[model samples]
Target: MIISILVLEGPYNHEASDSAYNFIQAALAKGHAIRGIFFYDDGVYNVTRLMDPPQDDRHISRRWSELGATGIDMVVCIAAAKRRGITNEVLAPNIRISGLGQLASMIHESDRIVTFGD
Candidate 1:
């Protein structure tokens, strides 16, 4: 099965991004395909590659990075990200900065749009 996810909550507060993260990891472990991960609302924090949490906590940033290394496309809502300050690196292509057009595009091109929101 092909699974795509939309995270509307953020990793800073609770593990709202956890569902998507765990889901994606499990899907890959089971040999399923991950279409992509779309971040919305506070979820845009997931794309801020500059995050640095204390050593006592889970390195949320690295976990997401690992997903990227594994080739699962991760996208953040452009408008939402701009408001919260998440952006794309000039060098990262797949992690491009995008908007609802891209979100709609993902929706149009995917099998599911599972959202994790408050």
Candidate 2:
């Protein structure tokens, strides 16, 4: 199955981000293909490379980068990113900034669209 994920919350503020991450990982492990991950609202924070969590904590942004390394497209809504002060200079290497049109395209192309949080 081809899956696309939309995340609506920030990384540490809620479990939604972690849940989405685990879901993607498990889905990939099961040989499912991920169409993409589109970040909106507070979820745009996931693409920021400036996140420096506690040493023992999981670096969510890094995990996203790693996932992108495996060829899964990762996108952050441009409006959302700008509203949250996430700029291209601070964006993760594999994360791209785009408009809602890209999200629409992902939804149209995927077999399933899974949304996390509000």
Candidate 3:
């Protein structure tokens, strides 16, 4: 099954984000393809490279980076990101530093869009 996940909360002081991360791993392990992981609200901060968590804890940013490295498509809504000071780097001919359009498109194209709420 193809899955597109929408994460709407940040990682601090919550288990929801970590739960979503584990769920993604399980989905991948079950041979389900991740169509996209879209971040909205505080969740957009998950992608910020500037994140520096405690040394002993699971770094959510690094976890996400690893997920991205696995070839899963990751997206963050522009408005939400801007509000949280998260910046999406766009270094291409078509892609730009922008909004929820790509995520909405991914949702529209996917068979499912699961949401994680805080």
Best by lDDT: 2
Query: Quick one: ranking by lDDT, best first?
Result: 2, 3, 1
Cα lDDT tens digits, model 1, 17-102, are 88778877777799877777887888877666677789898777678767777787777778887787665652133465667776
What overall lDDT, based on C-alpha atoms, would model 3 receive against the true structure? 0.76
Cα lDDT of model 3 by residue, 5-96, tens digit: 88888887667788889998899899989988887887776676766788998888778877877777777777877776666552111213
Clashing pairs in 3: none
Give me candidate 3's TM-score against the actual structure: 0.86
lDDT accuracy of residue 51 in candidate 1: 73
Predicted candidate 2 versus true structure: per-residue lDDT over 2-105, tens digit per residue? 99999999999999999999999899899999999999999998878999999999999999999988888999999999998998999988889999999999
Clashes of each: 0, 0, 0
